[model samples]
Target chain A: MAKPACKNLEEIFRTPHGAVYQCNRANCFWLEFAGGISAFKASDFLHLKKQVEQIDVPEMVQNTARMADIVILNPFRSERCFVLTVTDVLNLRELLQGAKVMLDLNSMLYDCLHAMAV
Target chain B: MKDLLRLRTSLTEEIETLLNEQIKVEAHSSSVYLAMSSWCNRNGFDNSADYFQKQSGEEREHMLKLFGFINDMGGRAISPEVTNIPQEFESFRAVFETALQQEIYVTQQFNRIADRCFKAKDFMSFQFIQWFLKEQIEEEYIARRALELFDVIGEEGTGRWEIDKQVPKIKYEN
Candidate 1:
C-alpha cells in the first residue's frame, strides 16, 4: 500500500482573500488565509468560527487606538496566529459562514442518502 | 470522500448551539441563586441563606452535567461567563418571589430546548433533557411552597422570623 502524496482536500469555501478546505484524509479543516494554510480539527474550526463571529466590527472601525486596529486568533493545536484587520475580519467571517452552511448542507445530504440506501 | 462533520460529532450544529445557550442559562441561574443566598445571609435569614446556597450548588451541578454531555458527544462545550447577578433584595418576601420566578424561567428554557430537540429529531438530546424537565417540577414546587409560607405565616411581627426558620424545612416529596 502507498500513501497519497497530496492532501485529499475538498474546497469548502473561497474568497479573494483566502479559502477553506476539508481534508478527508486528515479529518480536519485547512484554512488558507494570511498567505498560508493552517489546519484545525473540526471542533477547533467551529471554535475559530465563533471567535471570528464575536469580533466587534463596528467598534474596530470606530476606535482610533492603535491597539484596536486588529484582532488576533491563535487556533488550538496550531502554531499559526491570525492577526486580522477590520476588512480581514469581514472576509474571514464571510468565508467561515459559507463553509458552515455548506458543511450543514453536506450533513443533511448525507442523512438523506443514508436513508435512501436503507 | 468521508463525512468528516458526522464523524466529528453526533450533535447537529443547531443542537450544539442550543445546548451551549442552555449552559449559559444554567450558569446564570447558579449565580442568581448564590446572590440570593448572600442577600438572605445579610438580612439575618440564616436558614433561607442555607437553602439558597444548596440551590446554587445544584444548579452548578446541572451546568456541569450539560457540559459533560456536550463534550461526550464530541461537541465544543463553552464555559459560560455569567453576568448581571442581582445582589440586593427589596424585602424578605421578595427573595422567595424571585426564586419562584427564576424556577419558572428555567423550566421555560428547558421546555424550549426540548421542543427544539424534537423538531430537529435529535432524540438522544431530547432524552437527555427529560431529567431536567422532570427535576423542574420539584424545583418549582419547593420555591412556590416557600413563597406560600409568607401568606400562611402572615408577615407581621414574628412572621418573617418564622418564615425564615421554616424555609429550609420545605421539601418536595416524591
Candidate 2:
C-alpha cells in the first residue's frame, strides 16, 4: 500500500517518529504521530509543541525506570491520548525541531522577498 | 539557517504577546482618561477636565514609547484598538476614583511585564520598563492626590468646586 502523496499539502517537518503537514487551504496542521493522525489549529499545535518541550525528560529518565513512566498528550478535541516514552519524546523533539526550522525558513523567505519587492 | 523568528523579533512569542497586550491596556487607559476629561468638562469641573486631558496625553505618550521600543527591538508593534470607554461618570469624585483605579491598573500591568521579562530572561526589556515602573510612582501619586482632594475639601456644596479648582494644582512632588 502506498501512502497518499499530498502534493498540495506543505510538509512542514518530518521525522522517524512522525511528520507534520500544513494544509494551506484550511490553515491547519496535520500531525501524524504514533500510527495515528490528527488535525490541529496552528495555535493548538504551537501549544502542544510548547507542552511537549516543557516535559522534564532528562530528570524523569534519571529518576525512574525507562519503561514505567510515560508522557501523555491529551488533545482538547479528542478523548484519545498519545502516550510517549522517554525515547518517544526525543523523537518528538526531532520532529518539532524540523518543523521549527521549516517555519523559520518560510518566514525568512517571505521577509527577504518582501524586502526585495519593496 | 537563519533563525527568522529570533532574527526578526528579539522578543519571544510570549513576551511579544504580553507587550502587545500592555500596549492595548495603555491605549484603553488613554481613551478612558479622555472620556473622563470630557465628562469633567460637561460637569463644570473645568480644571479637573484639564487635568484629565493632560493625563490622557501622558498615557498616549507612554503607549507610543512602548510601541517605539518594541519596533526598535525588531518586534512588530501593534497599534492597539481601544474600546469600551465610559462617556459619563457618577460624579466629579467618581471621575477621580476611576482615574485612580486606572493608574493602579497601569502600574500592575507594568509590574506584570517586568515579571515576564525576568522569567524570560529578557533583561533588555526589563531594563527598558524600569523607566515605566518609576513613572508609575508619579502617576499613582498624582492620581491618588487628585482623588484625595474630594476627601480633604469635602464634596459638599461648593466643596467640589474648590476641589475642581485645585485639580490642576495637584502635582506629584516626587
Candidate 3:
C-alpha cells in the first residue's frame, strides 16, 4: 500500500542525499536516493548495507591520493547506484547504525511487553 | 514522537528477522529431504524414498506454519531464498547421517530463537517455538533410528535391501 515518495513510510535512516525508510505495509525498506526512491527486501537491505560498510573508504581515499574512487551502491535498481566519497561512507554508516538502533529498540519494547503482561 | 514504526505491525524487527531466518532453515531442510528422496528413488530404495518424501512434506509444513504465524502476527513472512542444497550425497547411510545432522542444526537454531525471545521477555514467541522443540525430538529420534539400521543390518549382501524395507516401517510411538 505504500507508494514511493509517500509520507506513509517510517524513516529509519536519513542522510543528506538519501534516507532509508521502512514500509510495514509492504514489509520492505524504501531507499530514497536523490529525488527518486527504490525498494529492497529486509535481507537485501542488510546485504546492501554490509557491502557499503565493507568498503574501506579511508584506504580508498589514501590509495586514490585524496580523489574519491567512487564507491557505488546499487540496490537492484539500475538508476539509483549511490555514488559515495570517504565522508559520505562515514555518514551512510552512521545513518545505518542509527536505524539499526531504532529497530532494536522497537523490538526490545515488544519483547518486554510480554514479560509485563500478567 | 509518534510511534510510526509499530503503527503498521506489532512484530518487532528482531523477532521478524529471526522468524525469517527460521523460515529459510525450514525451506532448506525441505529441499534437502526432497533431494534425498529423489536419490533414494534413483538408488532403487523404494521404501526409503517414501520416508524421505514424507520428511520433505513435514519440513515444508513447518515452513508454512512459521510463515502463517508471522503473517498472522502482522509481521512480514519472507519466502526464503534457499540455496546450496547438495544434490549428491556420499552413500545410503550417509543420507540418514546427514538427516540427523540437519535435525540437530534445526534444534540449535530454535534454541537460539527461544533464548533471544526470553532475553527480550517475549514469552509469546518463546511459547510459539515450543512445538518445534518437541517436534525436533521425534525428528532426531527417527533419523538416529534410521541410521542404526545401517549398523544393525550391516550392508553386506542383502543387508541394505533389508534395511531399505524397514525404513518405511520405522515409527516413534510417543
Q: What is the DockQ of each candidate?
A: 0.68, 0.07, 0.14
| lDDT: the better of candidates 1 and 2 | 1
User: Candidate 2 chain B, which ten residues in sequence have the lowest lDDT sum?
Assistant: B1-10
Off by over 4 Å in 2: A1-12, A15-118
Candidate 3's DockQ: 0.14
Global local distance difference test of model 3:
0.81
Q: Residues B1-174, candidate 2, lDDT per residue (tens digit)? A: 233345446776678778889999989999999999899898888988888898899999999999999888877688998888889888888888988998899899999999999997889999999999999999899889888888898989899889988888876776
Residues B48-121, model 3: lDDT tens digits: 99999999999999999999988887677989999998999899999999999999999999999999988866
**How big is the positional error of residue B65 in model 2, measured in Å on the Cα after superposition?**
0.8
Error of 1 at B14 (Å): 2.8
What tier of docking accuracy does candidate 1 attain?
Answer: medium
Clashing residue pairs in candidate 3 are: none
In angstroms, how far off is B125's CA in candidate 3? 1.2
Candidate 2 chain A, poorest ten consecutive residues by summed lDDT: A1-10
Best of the two (1, 3) by DockQ: 1
Local distance difference test, per candidate? 0.90, 0.81, 0.81
